[model samples]
Target: MLKKDSLLKGTIILAAAALVVRFLGLFQRIPLDYMLGSIGQAAFNSANTIYLLLLTIATGGIPLSISKMISTRYALGRPDEAKRIYQAALMFGAVTGLLLATAMFVLAPVYERLSRVPDSAVSLQAIAPALLLFPIIAMMRGYFQGRQIMAAGGISQIMEQILRLIGGIGLAFIVLGLGWGDKYGAAAVAFGSVLGSIGAFSVMMWFARKLKKQDRDEESAIATDKAAKPSSKLPFRTIYREIFRTSIAAVVTAMTVQFVYFFDQSFFMRLTSVFYNHDTAIKVLAEYTNRAMGIAGIPPILAIALGASIIPVISSAYALKNMEEVQRQSSLVMRIVFFTGVPVALLLTVASYSVTGLLFKSPSGYDTVALLTAGAIFQITMMISNSILYGLNKPKQPMYHTFIGLGLKVVCSLALAPFLGVYGLIIGSSICFIVITLLNVRTINKEINLNILGNKWFAYLAAIAVPALAGWGTEYLVLNLTDAWANKVSYFIAAAVTSVIVGGLYLIMLAALRVITPEDVRSFPGPLRKVLTLVLKPFYKRAA
Candidate 1:
């Protein structure tokens, strides 16, 4: 069994790697936006939305389930059985990926028709081939993740993004500069996805081979008694069945959020097209979706990193039937999420226009971006709660909560879209997340018989709200003060400066109020705390 310290260390390393990849993602999107422009970006985003939905279905839940199965097997000291389980999972994932990819690839025309955009047919066709590559990449990802070698997963993700960035931007510029139509430029961008998937798959396979060799060497050194070793030749069919059974719950649970997105996109498209001219409606929807994808997606990337790490640790603890440890870890994860999520969400919301302009040069998406930033509070809360629910072996509860949110989103979006357009989608999503978060919280309270929403809840709000307000005020001041030089770059710089100042001041305020305890501060990963200290030293020194 891995020690707590070892697990914590692993979590920190994985989180760092995830953060790097997310940061790289931000840089990559900038060039992609230039390549695709507004309409093309929209087309690409739509295709990716479909791909993400399938991805969630294909491999989302498998990692969690595989992690649980492998960890449990390891804890029980059956390495060979664990290896068999891993192989079975890989085989199953491969087949699932291929089937899903094929279906989606073939259904591109159907989706184009449903989307109701003039050139969506061509764009969708351009993106259809990517479906063939996505599932294979996802299967490889799930396999390595199950082995708890997240470094491989992290490296593969970075490599994929790098290839996409280089190939997409390069081809996009070439096509556009060569006087090719937008469709061709978009197609070139989409082609990058194929290259990225191949790079990811290659890296993962290499890592898997190395890991397999290492495992073999370790096993050879051990004294093998018949009692100590399980049967090496388990039936592949039995192994496949076991993996499929274990993975189904995870797949459903993982796809919940994506399902929400699918519902939103479908209804949003229908409502907008019905209420307005098709071209105008498509442009509006494209703008909003791009904004959400660009800005709102960032926090989840970060949250997922931390939340993913929590799953295996919490699952193992629960498997040992240690309720105290489960509660402790769950609480820690939620608190850390709040501590980071609150400030980031607030900053994003406050500086939404500045960020949107700086990142994508698309001012039309600012309002939706702001809404999504605010909505992230609920998103992060729901994510942490859902992770805890799953970790505690209560998968159905999360699924139920997610569906409730999904239903609410559909109804709310339809009711509000005519009047509010993209903002309606944002409002609906926020309301859905709030409802789901509350539901999950209530469920946890009932199960554990603990009032989680006591004084600490208020403290979380204070920790987030105070900094957000200060940051907003400071940013507003800076923007007005620098009006003479308020170009995009200047505005972005001012916003960044204000964000840092406000965030620092907010941390100091939290410290003064003791909202975050000394123990809480200490529990942060050492490197992170060091960075935080460096950022806040001036303020703390003043206070001291």
Candidate 2:
């Protein structure tokens, strides 16, 4: 069984890796945005939404299902059964991948009509092949996670994103240089999705093989001891049934955000058309939703990686019926996620214009970006909460709440769009996740006396206030200081200075308030822990 210490370490590793991958993705998107402009980005995003939907459906919750099953069995001292379960899951994944890829490739034309973006058809076809490869990658990562070996998954993710950045941007520039127009350039970038999946799958397959060999060697070492009483495996049908049961709930919970975003893709242009011409509406919607989403996407990486790392650990604890451990870990994860999320959301909101201008070479959608970044607090909280629910075998609760949130999003967007324009859609996204997160938090309180709003919560709020105020001051100073400089230079200076000041103040405030202790420092990676330890030890001495 994986220890809580190992789980914490694993979460740090995954979170750090996720940060790197997100940075790479940010780099890729910045250049890609410059190349595609708002309209091409609109087409690309629309096609990408379809791909994400199919990808989510095709894999569903299979990875988490596999992880939960394996961890449960492994916790019960049934290694052989866990191995058999993984083998069967691999088969299921392969077939699902094949069918989903074929379906997407063949139905590209129909999807084009549905999305109302003709250029999306080419992008859709380019991204179709990835559906065939990613399921296997996900399954292997899940297996390693169940084994509490997070580095393999982290490594594979980094490798996948590296290849994606190189291949996608390289091809995009190649196409653009050849004078092929943004349509072809976007398609070329989409084709890189397949390459990225292939790279990740290859890396995961290598690790899976390595793990299999290690497992075999360990089994050989214990062969004599196990020979007397070998455990029997579950019936294939029974295993499949359990997998599907878990998967359906997981899929619903996991796909909530994607489905909501897909709703935006499907209706954004049409709804905006009520205010402007069709082409103009498309461009406006693209600027508001697509660009804003891209900028907003980066901050959730750490929460997502931590949530992913927590699932199998939490599942294993639940399988052992350790309610205390479950409660402790769940509360801790939520606190950590919230602590990271609050300042990020605040800083992003405060420096939205600078950040948008620096990264996208324009400040056109800064308001939307600011709103979405603030909404990320809800989004990140909901992600971690959803994982905890899944770990507790309460997946249906989150799934139901997500539907409520999605319904609210649709209704709010429809009612507010005509008057408020694209900002209405941003409102929908924010309110949807905030309501969903609150519901999830209430459920968690009942499940495990989390004390989410106790004195510690006040400390967290106080800690956040320091950085929020400092961030605004720094942004103002830098922007005013760089007024004589070029636009990009001014934005870069403001964003960079504000980021440093905000980050430093946030950490210091946490340390001073005693909200972050030595134990928390140990949860970070070695280098970070060292730096934090240095900053925190004086406080520790005073507290003692």
All candidates: CA RMSD (Å): 3.7, 4.2
lDDT of each: 0.71, 0.80
Q: What is the C-alpha lDDT profile of model 2 across 1-544, one tens digit per residue?
A: 2222286777777788888987886677777667886667877777777778877876778776787788888899888789888888778778888988888788878877776765777887788888888887788877887887888778888988888878988999999999998888888888888889988988887877777787778777874666665766778798889888878877887787788788878787666667667777776767665567777877788777878777877888989989888887887777667666667778888889899898885888788888878888888988988888878878889988998999999999998777777777878988889888888888877768774435666787888887888888888888888899999999998998898888888877787887887877786546657887887788788778
- Segments in model 2 whose C-alpha atoms lie over 4 Å from true places: 1-9, 71-83, 212-235, 309-329, 453-477, 500-544
> Which residue segments of model 1 deviate by more than 4 Å?
1-6, 71-87, 212-233, 274-276, 316-322, 449-453, 456-470, 523-544
lDDT of 1 by residue, 221-247 (tens): 977786755576768787667666766
What local lDDT does model 1 show for residue 535?
58
Lowest summed lDDT window (length 10), candidate 2: 1-10
TM-score per model over all chains: 0.87, 0.86
Cα deviation of 346 in candidate 2 (Å)?
0.8
Candidate 1 backbone collisions, by pair:
61-250
TM-score of 2: 0.86
Q: What is the lDDT of residue 83 in candidate 2?
A: 83
